[model samples]
Structures are given as C-alpha cells and as structure tokens.
Target: MSEVNEQMMPPKVVLPKLEKNLYEARAIKSFLLTAMVWGLVILASIPLFSVIYMLIVEGGARLDWEAITALPPAGFETGGGFGNAIVGTLVMVGIASAISIPVGVLAAVYLSILEPQSKLATTSRFLAKVLTGFPSILAGVFVYAILVITTKTYSAWAGGVALAVLMLPTVTLAAEEAMRQVPQRMRDAAFGMGCTRTQVIFKVILPTGMPGILTGVILAVAGAAGESAPLLFTALFSNYYMAELAEPTASLSILIYNFSGMPFENQIELAWAASLALVVMVLFFNILARIVGRSKF
Candidate 1:
C-alpha cells in the first residue's frame, strides 16, 4: 500500500524556458514605451497647432504690403498701416541688443571662466537670476524713473535701455551655461598643448560655445521686440515716423495695444495685422536660433 501511495505522488516538475517569457515581456515594454512617447507628442502638439491656426484665421486677410509700409491712419478712417511701428521696433531692439550683448557676454566670461569661485562672481550670478525673474512692468517703471524722468521726456533711447535691462540677465546666464558645456577634457588638452588661458578661451572655448550663446541672444532679442509695457512707459507712442532716438517711437506692440481697444473696426484690423507681423518676427528669430544651434564651425 505504501509503495502504491509513493507511486501515485506527483513527480518533480521540469523547469520551463524563461527566455521566451522574458522576450515577450520585453516586447510589451517596448510597445508601451512607444505608445507613451506618441501620447506625449500629441499632447504637446495641441496648443502649438491651436495658436498657429488662430493666428492664420484672424490675421492672414489683414496682412499686406501697406501694413508694412504706410503710417497708421487716425480716428475710425480706414486705409493705414504700421510702417513706423515696425521701424521703431527694429531700431529699439537693435539698440538693446547692442547694449546687452557686449556687457552680458563679458560678465558671463568673467563669471564662468575668470573667477567662478569668487564672491563677486557668486553675487553677480545671484543678481542675474534675480533680475531675470524681475517683473517686466517694474523694469518699465525703473527705466521710466531713471531715464524718462531725468530727460523729462519719453524716448526710444529710454525704451532701448529698458529692454537692455530686461535682456542682460537672460543673455549672461545663457552664455555662461553655454561656456560651461564645453568639455573639461578639451580645456585640459589645450593646457597640455601649452596654450595660454586667453588663447585657449578665445580660440577653442568661444568657438565651441558660440552656437548656444547666439541662440540665447536671438531669443532675448525676440522677447525684447514683443515687449509693450516697457515701451509704453519709455518710448510712448508716436503717430508719425521716428525722427530721432530721443523722440517718442512707435512699435508693433504699442500699436496693438493702442489699436486693439479703439472703438473702430479699422484700428482693430490694423491691430490684428500688427499682431500677425509681430508673431512672424518672433517665429523667424526662433527659426534662426534653431539653425544657429544646429550649425557646425
């Protein structure tokens, strides 16, 4: 009976191959990963596509060569453009870029390369971050107090200064980050080659980091171009073309602000057209930045 019971007992089971199940699990994981990636892509695309669609629908019909060349008309009368505003925007943004790029890049070089561990560098870096987050309106107010008040008049020069203040930290931090991204090994190799510090930096490091630094400058300029609050306080608005840097200037943003609220359909249309042009300007700068970032040399 005992022998019969032992014979009826279950035999030791043989192990099945785990490799097949493992491969199946891996396939499932890969599929899930692909699905997640596509899901995120679709999620991100919704808002971007929506903005582009809105811009086209609302502004496409209003865009014309006149919009780019003629002075805006007065009152409710139709048949005008934002030529002065476009030109003023360019002039002010150019001034801001000229001011910020050199000072910002020099500060970045000092902080990132010269004396990174010094107290002054730390303070400068901290101040830059603070300024970067400072309110745009406050920048306007600051410039208004300093320049406009001193000069007793709002001018394109004041507007340019305001934009320069806004752009300084952005350019400095971006440039420093770009410089930091240069491989330490490359720096060491330059040193091993008996290159002087200045030689290595100017020849090797700056070249390697130019793409990112230029990208930052381009983006900063785009942001400066779109700003209305600072220009409102500093540049004011002019019905005519800018005659001098110290005179009030027209900009696309201020035009949009001035026109969008007017109880006139003509002005409203001009606003939309100006808005479209501003959007195109910013988009072009972004594209240019991307191209620069991807460029080699």
Candidate 2:
C-alpha cells in the first residue's frame, strides 16, 4: 500500500532560469547607467543655480520702482530708471515676431510637407541653416549697411528688421522639425477619411504642430531680446522714451552694457539691476514656452 501511494505522488516542476553571472552583469550595468545619469544631472545644474544665486543677491537690492519707470540718469548722477529701454525692447521684439512667425511657419510647411526633397526646398533649407549659423554681429552689420545706411539713421525700424532676420532662420528650422515630428500614419489616416490636402495641412497637421512652433518662436524672441550688438548698430541709443520706430531706441541690454563699465557706483548698481531684469525676462519666456508647448489641444 505504501509503495502504491509513493508512485501516485505528483512530480516536482522545473523553473526556467538565467545563468547567475548573467544576472549579476545586468544588475551591475543598470547600477552604472543610473549612477552616470545622476552624476551628469548634478554637474549640469551647479553652474546654472550658481549664476541665478549671484544675480539674485547682487541685483535684488536695487530693484526699485524707479528702476522700472524712470529714464536712466546721466553719468555720475543716479536718480532714474529704464522705462524707455523696456518699451523699446518690447516694440522691436514685437515687430520681429510679426515679421518672422507667418513667413517662417509657411516656409517650413512648404519644405516639410509639400516638397521636402525638391531642389528649391533643399536650397532653401541650406540657406536657412547658413543664416542660423551666421554671426549675430554680422546680422547687425548687414542691416547696418543696408537699412541703417540706406535710411541714413540708426533707427528702431532697422533694429526690428535685423532681429527679424535673426529670428527667421531659427523659427523656420524649428518649425520644420516640429512639422516633421507629426506622425506620417496620422496624415495617412486623415487622407483615408476623405480630407483634402489643404484640410489635412490646416485642420490636422497645423494643430498638432502648433505647440512646437510656438516654442521655437518664443526661444527666438528671447535670444533677440538679450542682443545688444545688433541693436547698437541699428537702434543706436536714446536717452528719452521711444517716440517713433524711425528714431533711436533704448533697450535693457544696451543699458546694461553702458552701465556695467561705468566709473560711478550708481551706474554699476543699475547695471546689476538691469542684468537681473534681463535674466528674469529670459527665464519667464522659457517657462512660458514650456507651459505652452505642454498644453493640450
């Protein structure tokens, strides 16, 4: 009876297994990869935070009401602000955006959607890239020679045009990249649903790509806003509020540059203050871009 019961007992099941050394290697590799990633993250953040900390400590003390609303005081005297400079910066940046956005987005659509491999598209892309890599100072020089010299003045209009030139290639390249990121399968599905090419472009593609395009435009404007060299050649400088695009205009960057190297203590303080303001502006735009790009349709 005992022998019969033993024969009827269930057999043990065998489990599939990897070699022990293989498991150890994988675990070590994962640990190394994670450590490298965190190490790089820490390294990258240190300098950025250091700069922000310095700006806050040095500039926060002098960020007063006058700094926002009064004209800069003359050398060695200290009782004014950057009201006009802020206005001029906004005006020129506005004009640049107005010129670049529509034209750049359209060109991107033509290249990425209509004829990506065509000779014209290729040449257009190549030139856009060339412009992107072209020195910002050269952009100022080019506009100086053409618009500033032709108009016979260093005017806000010329500054805006130079910024637009700087913005155009950046916007176009980024927009093209964004458009290409839209899934081909999605386009095919739209077409399969009886959508015309125009409908597909406007209704389908544009909506999906809008956030990325907006991000590119925001970055372009942010860079242009901090530029002093281009504005120097084009807008020159104004001690008074900007009365017209046809006249000299002041900007925060120019104010910072002029003040930072001054012999007077007040000018140095104001330069630090302007630096802080410029940093805040750039940081705000960057945050806004991220938020806008992440928004749902």
Query: Pick by TM-score: which candidate is best?
Result: 2
Can you write out model 1's per-residue Cα lDDT over 1-297, one digit (the tens) per residue?
999999999998999876545358788898899999999999999999988787787777888998899999999578899999999999999999999999999899999999999999999999999998898989999999999999999899999999999999999999999999999999999999999999988998889999999999999998999999888899999989999999999999999999999999888888888998999999999899999988976
* Residue lDDT tens for model 2, 62-100: 888898889999996877888888899989999999999
Per-residue error (Å), model 1, residue 280: 0.6
In model 1, what is the error at residue 241, expressed in angstroms?
A: 0.9
Per the 3 Å backbone cut-off, how many clashing residue pairs does candidate 2 have? 1
Candidate 1 residues lying further than 4 Å off, grouped into runs, are: 1-47
Give the local distance difference test score of model 1: 0.93
